[model samples]
Target: MVGLLVLAAFLTLADRWAVLYAEHRAADALKDRLKLTAAPEVEIDGFPFLPQFVDGRLGSVKVTVPDVSADRITLASVSATARDITLDGDGPTSVHGARVPELNGDVLLSFADLNRELGASQVTFTGEGRDRVLARGTLPVAGHDLRLRADVRIGRAGDQGIATTIGGMRLDVGDLATYRPGARASEGLHLTPKSVTRLARETRKVRALLGVPSVVRRMGVPDATVREALRNDDKLAALTGSRDFVHQAMRVNLLDLTLAHPEVLDRLGLDPALLDALSRLTRPVLADQLSLGFRLPEPERGELWLRDVRVEKGGIRVRLAGQGLAFGD
Candidate 1:
């Protein structure tokens, strides 16, 4: 009886290895099919597999794809669980194909990944300790790039899915001389968007106020609407007052803005950096598809259901459920 037990144990262990080896091969095939950057983690659930191996069936199988970057956005992971998988009975040496009952899983995408997609040159994102994210980056103000940081609060955007809002809008100069009088001696008027007119075309009016340069107002508008800073000459002088070399810097930073067309990039006092800021968000990212949930109907001859998604830290974790799996040669 003891010898028989030893033989059974060995057979079970060997059977498990065989199943794992076969799974590795299948995962390789899956990798090719999905065009994955890396092969996913695969596991067969339960133990003492000799019986299941002989029958060419599996109780359940789990698969995890660590990172799925559909476009600019990267989902942390996508997991699926297959239940009651029926394998090709003819492939005794290798379990090929399966009939699944029902499969369910989750796809997780976190805020950190979003920041990563923002690019290394952009701001770095940090966790706010409570379910929130903090990001700091240079903002374009008055055509100048100013140091700015914003707290992105999570909120739902009606039918648009999850959304974010900017908070704690603050823009500052690194050199005291830029804002402080006679400290290091800067050039031009270092102003923010708020210092200028509230309208887009009015961007030209900002330069007029700084006493920098003039602009040819676009067609079909009131002259007063497109008035140059020279019109605000008195106000421009008042703006300088005693603010030392700052008058020489002539750079303006635009901050906390809702919208600006790329056409206004050539406007002065506007940091060319605004090009990055405007283009970065406007280039048409695949963010919509990333935010949208996904479902794989026949991953393994069964439907793998993707139900819920939760974002955390650098990655996401998902739970899976499955059904109606059928395996054939």
Candidate 2:
């Protein structure tokens, strides 16, 4: 009985040694096969190694790799579980090839890493709902820092691409108004009722309007009436206090107005460069900045594709699947 117990202990140690050696070999092989920057951590499950080794099959294997660069973005980490792995050699040390019947993985794009990599405009992304994310930050435009907020939807673009659709992107132009970028001037700067009312009360703004004689003339106010209002505070207030003027001002297409009368920008203390910048920030261009679309690199040995996308607290997670994966075959 004592002799049997000693033999059992020896077998157990030998079994453990075999598993470790196999794991090391598998890690190195995968690193080379996947072209990974470093060897991934590999673990084979369902121990009592000798039987599985003899049969040349591993029931389950887990692999994790970090900092995988995919297109313009970097995946924080990628983890996968491969199942029904069939080894093609007599033993661990002599193993030359293997086949994975099925595998599922998760590619995590952590917000911290995203902020460091894709946050060129100081914009940062955060998960909004199960399928959406919110981007908020500042964009530099013509020497002024403009605040921006956007709602983005997460979805699969193709079999292996994850994409973002931006909606309701707004840029704040100080206290003047919110700019809604678009393909045409009809969808330009918009002023809320409160902003319109506030503008009517600002003395400097009222003075600036009076300073532009052409604008006064276009408003159908005679030069004498404008001169009189320029001297008397009550006259100027009465002239700007009319309901029709305030209502029309709120509905004015600032972009069209500025394009038609370039002097309007000067009168409003806005640089012409600001308009040039806004012209280039159309809907599509702005959306491109927040686009998270990326395609996974095709592996040399097997089929891999993106399955789904989800917005999680950590970041955007894209589900991946693979089949018939083989190494060194």
Candidate 3:
């Protein structure tokens, strides 16, 4: 009986040791895959018996990352959990209640801020199924305050291959310096449709003069509308109106505008004699239509804020002084 008891005790010790070994290995592998410089420490306790290598349960694994940096930005207190882990070769790993405490940098700018400042922001990435990324915070520009939030998605489909979508995004500009000093910074102004229409008309005329049929075609209007707009000055004028109607129309047909037209190119201001030579060189490029929206508080010079101001491939919308919002025709 004494010998048997001793053997049982030895076996129990061996089982606990094995579980600890496996848990450590898995944690190490994960840290490497994430390119984490600060390796995670794991501890395991409580095993009734020597677990089978195939279905062992990890009592607990805690991962702590102190500081992770990319360029100028540094993320502190980043952690996650794998609450319950099973050593099954076929089942997918599940993670729950994951979060990062804070991300700070000299300047952490998002897509919206970059777009507003520079007119465009281009991002390219590769990943697997329905991945979502989010960022929120404030960015200061030349004494003006700006708040930004953005959500983006990357999706994959069997037939479509890889696709990306900008789920939702918003940029709030507060305390913008109005044209007039002593003016309330929050009083926001709305961009007029007339401005949008005028720009659209100018674009079409330039496209026609350049003799670029493909350029006009890409604007997505029915060939009939393009033909009619080209032939009748009044129709084109009416369609452009004083709003963003033209901007929206062209956004839908961006892909088709690549074909070139000499007449349209000439109208863009190149000499007629040079039209033929430049025809091959003329390329279709996207244009950004300017839209402005403003809002004013009770006291006109108290505070000016710009809200619901957005520019997209299709159109622009803005609200001024809590009212008089406008969209291009």
Every candidate's lDDT: 0.50, 0.80, 0.36
User: By descending TM-score, how would the candidates be arranged?
Assistant: 2, 1, 3
Q: Any runs in candidate 3 off by more than 4 Å, and if so which?
A: 1-150, 153-196, 200-255, 259-329
Residue 153 alpha-carbon offset, candidate 2, angstroms: 0.2
* CA RMSD of all predictions: 10.0, 4.0, 20.9
Quote each prediction's TM-score: 0.55, 0.83, 0.27
Candidate 1 deviant stretches above 4 angstroms: 89-91, 110-113, 127-134, 139-305, 314-329
Over 1-329, each residue of candidate 1 has an lDDT whose tens digit, in order, gives 99999998888789879778867977886687788999998887877665775777779788888888745567778777777777764667755566766676666666576667763436566656444556667644346555645565554343223454554433454432122111121312244333332322343544533332222221122345335324565544443332431322234322212134323334433455543443343212312212323333344454444333334566433444555655445
Write one digit per residue (lDDT tens) for candidate 3, span 1-329: 99999998888878777666655765676477557775665545445524434344444344554444433223333333323434433422322211222211111123343334334232211222225444344433334334544454433322212233443333343321111111132112211233334446575653342234444443445667656666777766665563545454333221122233434323433334422222221111100111111122232222222322323322222222212111111
| Cα misplacement distance, residue 142 of candidate 2 (Å) | 2.5
Q: Which candidate ranks first by lDDT, i.e. highest?
A: 2
Model 2 spans with C-alpha error above 4 angstroms: 89-92, 184-186, 191-195, 202-239, 242-247, 257-260
Per-residue alpha-carbon lDDT of model 2 for 107-170, expressed as tens digits? 9998888888878879998998888889999988888888999998989877878877899888
TM-score of 3: 0.27
